[model samples]
Target chain A: MVEVQALSKSYVGRTVLDGVSLSAPQGAIFGVIGPRGAGKTTLLKILATLVAPTAGDAFVAGASVVSEPLRVRRQVGYLPNDFGVYPDQTCAEYVEFFAACYGVPARERAALAADLLQLVDLYHRKDTPADRLTPAMRYRLGIARVLAHDPRVLLLDELTAGLDPRARVEARELLKELSSMGKTILLTAPNLAEVQDLCTHAAILHAGQITQAGPFDEVLATTPPYRTIAVKFLGDVRLAMNLIKAANGVVDVQPFNEPASPSDALAGVTLLKELRVTFDGAYADASVLLRSLMHSGVQVVSFAEEN
Target chain B: MRAPHLKLPALELSPIFAKEMAGRMRSARAYMVLTVYLAIVSGLSVLLYMVSFLGSPRTVSGSGAVGTVVFYFLVGMQVLLASFVAPAFTAGAISLERENKTFDVLRVTLLTPAQIVWAKLISALGFTLLLLFATLPLFSLAFLLGGVEPRELIIALCVVFASALMYALLALYISARSRTTVGATLSTYAIVLGVVIGIPLAALIGSSTVSLALAPTSGSSSPLADLFDTLLTLAISLSPISAIAASQRFFSATGELWTFTPSFTGSGLALTLPSPFLILTGVYLIASVILYMLTVRRVARIEQQ
Candidate 1:
């Protein structure tokens, strides 16, 4: 378990982490989302015992980061955004050194190193030096290095950033597997869609503070009531715009920039519109408007939900 | 059952010392230092043999071979190598870690600051000593020439070893405090050179004035020169190069580290003893330890966000 009690940090005169508090229970994947420069990294570093908070306390597995950093380090594994790995050391040599630093016995180091390499799927690249490893492979190596000690808590910062789509998907799968093994995972990411898909619980960070937090469903429910829907229309955009403007449920109508509302590309017609409905849990409101549009003989080619 | 959780001890971690030493030992720089040391030793040996083979066998009054050219050559090598190589071995020890960005990895480990510092100091110079010991055959072979004594060889090695320790500590201390290897390397060189060259020269220049003021009746140059030279040499000897100058003070017939006096007019000259290099080297050793400990403290508490 990890608890951050009103944690705060500052560099020079500028505050980074304002009095923020959070707790991650055993076996939970807690994702933190924020835009650039929102202090996600600072909070994670403090929890890792890499930096001290200007004020407040962070405890990892019941060990205070400030007072018992060694104990804290032993329990929490931190993977920084850049994932600094020593350039010259090969993957196996790198893990071996960390295992030694972690004071895993000399006899057990090779086995542990092999296990971590296999876990990260870098067993094939074990002989390659860190500088030669691809960014995605480096990220895997970073994860493996952290887990070499078998820590209870993982403070992962932007694990999927800089990775290609396929790599990101694979990384997400690995995280889910680690989370299932009873590891309390604290993840930070910039991709909101990825956050929504992967996070069981998440907090939206803004301007050095968590603006909204909880399980995905709870956070979504508490966030401003806004719903978006997409529609493909069988006519020029003028016809779709007029139909959306006259609709009972839709509050905002915007044209979608696809299958351009030109007569040339239309089977009969081709246009798409994105509609935002300002309704608080009213499914009938949207259904009523769709019925009214269809009754007007404006053929709705396709419809779907969106952000 | 599990033996323990998080039982890693701060003192037990190797940090990067072993790797650094291993890497350094394999570098051309290590071989260069060894080569230079060996060249000085052998070149000096050959030069002395050439001079002795041609020149008349000399004596310091009644004591035969006490002030032989052979004795001075062996002692010269010990001092020259200590002054030249000790700083080279240590100056980049910790700063290289900073330049390479590996200091943070070592710092975040369970290893305490002092342990890291100790490990660095030891590993930086340990390989150099191993290389130095490899030349034992060459140094031992110097004994076959017969002018050198077993005790003198022992004392020379002791002085050389002691000087190396002092130089290593001083250089390591500088490496720890500085942000770059260049800074540590340059500062150590400057400081070592100052001790080796600056102190004796300054004292030599100042001694005449000091002597004239202290005793107007004495026109004796040796009194001023010897007095100031001994004191200046005391400081110089504090460096590893002290082994250089003290190497000249090989065993006399009386088994003393003393030299016979120059005959003063009318009165008998007193035997002047070379200042004990070990005592000065001891002071340097103590200072080096204190500096190393200070470095360990600073290294341990470093944290970056």
Candidate 2:
């Protein structure tokens, strides 16, 4: 439930965001992926109503950012990429403080803070000082703090920037759960792979402009059609190479070498050779190719597509 | 037809106020400051009592003089303490939010800019009032000796409170305009010192110059002389210390709450002036409102930065 129409923001003579437009449907996880300094954070800030656009306007939950910023603020919760916590406040107090700021009745604030902390998996640390928590926990606290007001739209800037792999996966799952609960989420990431599986809709922002925006698959479709399939195997490298070359939709095959992974070595398997095969085909066709290779009696170690 | 129903907005305590107060009061620093302030005032009160009364023969008139000395000393210490600590309380109110990157998060909330500014201001002032009120017993020492009137004591406390308020608001305004806590604090103290020291210094020089210039026309009524007198009164009122001293002088001279100025030359216009305490209080209240509005505007414009 967010619409940005030709939003442009500039400072001095330099443009930070230029004519950027995108729409996020209600309950959809929309991701704006870009490299550092590509204006993803700037775009989200405009939607969050923390920064005014130099030109044009954005609407969050039907309120214009320019004309009705207070109304927009009421409907949107923003989590900045980097923020500090009140060191003296307990985690629950931090959340409750924001709850009060949102005008939640004082009597209900304690219960609400508890529920929000539980949602973010931080209930155990409710009484801990916010600044004393680990970075990941602090990030979760930020999430809970944003949810205190139960806004209709959430603008999360670089949601997984500094998270560990496990925490990143958990954050992705949380975003999915939030989407299922009918919350409109607009998150940013430094790369597409970070949000590829999680975002229902995605946009590629590069140099203050949107190069691509749409359904996740549709955006991927706009890219080059060639896909690289990596195959690792144990025995008869030549045979596996031959099989890969014979597969349907195989455009090219290149043999490569790498030491076996610790897991493979620990399993007492050795002499693994990897091959990179460029293939163009549908999902079913790829599956058939895999089955034919297996039927040909090549001991396949692993087969996966490389983004 | 029935008149339309008018709904007054409900009063709600600001979350910022609640949060700031809880954090500030819970910290050891608040109590440490309170303890040290009371200790100093207490020690000084005892020292002053001994020096003024016990150092020589005890008499009714002597006790009264001792009480007056003790009372003025305590009040002077209160004003000095407030001037020093009030700015420290608020100099980081907004700038620290910016440094910590919480400004945007707070701004995105439903609280209005005015709410944020006023909440911060009131929270700081609340702590300052606590520091002032903590010394009530020390003030009662002067009262028990029977020299200081209740009205005088109350008016003196008002002057101290108003000065603290002015200091706090000035710091908050500077905090809203500054990008860093250090910068805001330094700027606030600089301006506070200038007002405290420079204004009276400038008034002293100006009045002297005016007197010398009007020496030839001393016996006659000149508008320049009257204007200079008005300016002198205002200048003295602006400085809290001078205002306190002037208020005491006014009280002892008239034994009235307020009085008008009579012309130095009877032939000239008789200018009506409120007592220095009233003038100081009025100026502080008005300046506080203006500073509050400016701070609110500055906060509202933070998005542009």
Candidate 3:
């Protein structure tokens, strides 16, 4: 488990993190999302016990980060965005070295290193020099290194950042496996879609402050109720727009960009124009409005939620 | 039933030390440095031997004089080379981690800050010891020629080893505080210059003025003369160069460690007790420990966002 209380950090005259608080339950994957310079990395560092908060405190696995950093470190495995591996050392040697640092006994280090390597699917390449691995392979090796001690909590800062799409998907799969093993994880990413897909809980940080945070479903439910539906019509767009505006639950109507409409590539779909309609009610109301358009003899080429 | 257990102490050699040793020992840089260091010492020793052999009167006693010159030359050369190489080995020890962005991972490990600092310090010193030991055969070669006592050889090694420890710690402290490896490297060299050249030069000038001021005493015994001699000895004893010079004095059977008879009253005053080499080594070892602690503290402070 990880808990942060009123954490704030500043450097010189600039404030980086201010009054940020969140919690991650055991075995849940908690994610942080933000734009560039949103203090996501700073918050992770504070939780990792690598940096002290200017005010407030963090606890990992029931140990206070400020007062019991060594204990906290023992319980937490932090993987920074750009953790480097030592040159000229094989993957197994690198992991075993960290294993020994964590006080894993000599008798067990080899097995643990081999286990982690297999877990990250790098067991076959265990003898390859660390610096010789490709970027994706190196990232997997870093994950293996962090798990040498089998800490209860994992702090991952942008594990998928700068990775290609295939590598990102693979990394997410590995994270899911870790999460299944009862490891509480705190990770950061710039992509909201990725975070929503992988996280059970999440917090959105904007300009050093938590704007919205909660269980994934609760946050998704609380998003703005305003919904826009786009429809590409085959006939006069003005007539279709008027018909949709007159339908029940329709708040407003506006023409959308031509290229954005899906009717551009459809053969025999001449005079195709897109109209966007605003709805303030539930999904049933939008469905009723769609039915009313069909009954009015207006041919709708494509219909979907715009945002 | 639990398996038979063997618990190792938590403070054994850190994984950082093992990792660094594995990488550094395998690198071509280590062997290259060893070769260059031995080559320089060999070249200088042969040149010094030729000069002494050709320039001196050919006699059984001449070999003693030749051995003395060669011994001092080797000591001075090794000390100079060690001073140059010690900082280079350690000044980047931590800063290179920062450059590689690996320090954050290290900081989050269960290893304490002291473990990290000591691991780096010991690894750098181990490499230095390798370099120091590489010259043992050469020193032995000089010993076979004559006139260099085992005690003097031991003392010189102690002085050089102590100097290496001091330089290693100084560079490490800078490495811990610096953000870039290049910056740490430059700062280490600058501070080494201040220790080796700057401090001794200032002390020489200061003590010379004191001696000049007392020169006009005009054949009268005074406590002020003792003060001047003490100041000179203290200044020299604090630096590596003067420490090595004091060892030379011990080998030459001069009044032990800056003791001299006064010109006017036929009395003698010893400026230092025990020995100048001991004083110098003691000061440097204490300072290095203090710096090591400070480095551990400094490294514990994480300063990035």
- List TM-scores for all candidates, in order: 0.73, 0.82, 0.80
Q: Per model, how much of the real contact set is kept?
A: 0.22, 0.51, 0.50
lDDT per model vs. reference: 0.68, 0.83, 0.79
Superposed Cα RMSD, model 3: 10.7
Candidate 3 is scored at a TM of 0.80
Pairs clashing within candidate 3 = none
- What is the C-alpha RMSD, rounded to one decimal, of candidate 2? 11.0
Write model 3 residue lDDT over A1-307, tens digit each, in one string.
8999999999889999999999999998998866558899999988888788899899888899889888887788888887788776899998888778777777888888888999999999999999999778888998898788888888898867656557878899999999998899999865355566789998878789998788977765764344667787677777787778777656556565433335545754446677766656678877887787788877877888864
- Which runs in model 2 stand beyond 4 Å of their true positions? A224-307, B1-9, B54-57, B204-230, B260-262, B266-268
Tens digits of per-residue lDDT, candidate 1, A1-307, equal 8888888887887888888887778888888766457888888878877778888998889999889998988887778776466665789878877777777776777778788888889999998987799778888888887787788888898768677657888888888888887789998865345566677787877667878877877876676554566676565566666766666645445443433346645644433443333322367767776776677776776666666
C-alpha positional error of residue A270 in candidate 3 after TM-score superposition, expressed in Å: 37
Clashing pairs in 1: B79-B244
Task: Give candidate 3 misplaced runs (Cα > 4 Å).
Answer: A224-307, B1-8, B202-226, B250-274
Candidate rank order under lDDT: 2, 3, 1
